[model samples]
Target: MDVDNGMLLCPTHDALFDKGFISFNDDGSIYISNKIDKREYELLNINKDIKLNFKREQLPYIKWHRENEVQ
Candidate 1:
């Protein structure tokens, strides 16, 4: 995999992401899957306000992940 295809995340968030419970918008904001209950957001420490800094080259990978992995 290309380095740009990788993102550094905490174990909890990483697992959530890998499980398709979360993704990200092109603007870098977090995209929580509807499959997740609203209450779980607080329990998981996730919120709509969260965002990551992404490079332009990473957008394509992000798009692919969102399409294929995210619920």
Candidate 2:
């Protein structure tokens, strides 16, 4: 586990993110969670076109998170 290969998501987002229920694109755009209820957007802050502050090096980790952890 590389320390710098991690994301800075909030606790809620982190849980989903790590499990690949949520993810980000190569350009750092967020991937919405299908499992999460749309009505709970305000509580989870789910939004379209959301860009995370990620560096290029974090891409591999992001991909791994998406591919290996997706439900």
Candidate 3:
């Protein structure tokens, strides 16, 4: 939703991002593992530390939710 990144989110599972350029399925769901790639991996490592910091800044809202939730 910000100006820096172009990411798409799945409502069902807010943990996943459509960074692979794939849209939602007919059932309105997405499987991220099937879309993982070198760029995503690199982005993960690069963003891991940041994701650990200010989680709300991450694209996937579920990540922030999980990061804030108490187990």
Candidate 4:
């Protein structure tokens, strides 16, 4: 795996991401899976307002995750 193919996320967010509960749009906007309950958003401290400052080189990896890993 490439070193650039990684993101720095907290444990909770990391787990959620690993499980395909979250992703990101090309613009870096957070994309929560439909499978996640609305109520759990508050408990998980995640919201639609979250965004990432990602490099252009990371887009390919992000795209792969969105297309293959996200729910």
Q: Global lDDT of each model? A: 0.91, 0.76, 0.36, 0.91
Could you report the Cα RMSD, in angstroms, for every candidate shown?
Answer: 0.8, 1.8, 12.2, 0.9
Candidate 3: worst-modelled 10 consecutive residues by lDDT: 46-55
Please provide TM-scores, in order, for all candidate models, with all chains considered together. 0.94, 0.76, 0.21, 0.93
In terms of lDDT, the poorest run of 10 residues in model 1 is 39-48
Residue 29 lDDT in model 1? 94
Give residue 26's error in model 3 in angstroms. 1.1
Of 1 and 3, the candidate ahead on lDDT is 1
lDDT string for model 4 (11-68, tens) is: 9999999999999988999999989999899999897798898889899999999999
For candidate 4, list the clashing residue pairs, or say none: none
Which digits, one per residue and each the tens of the lDDT, describe model 2 over residues 15-71?
778776788877888777678777887787777668877777788888877777776
Off by over 4 Å in 3: 1-20, 31-71
Rank all candidate structures by their lDDT, best first, as comma-separated numbers: 1, 4, 2, 3
Which parts of model 4 are misplaced by more than 4 Å?
A: none
What is the C-alpha lDDT profile of model 1 across 1-71, one tens digit per residue? Answer: 78999999989899999999999989999999999999888889887798899999999988998999997
How much RMSD separates candidate 3 from the native structure?
Answer: 12.2
**Ordered list by TM-score, greatest first:** 1, 4, 2, 3
Clashing pairs in model 2?
none
Better of 2 and 3 by TM-score: 2
* Candidate closer to the true structure by TM-score (higher is better), 1 or 3: 1
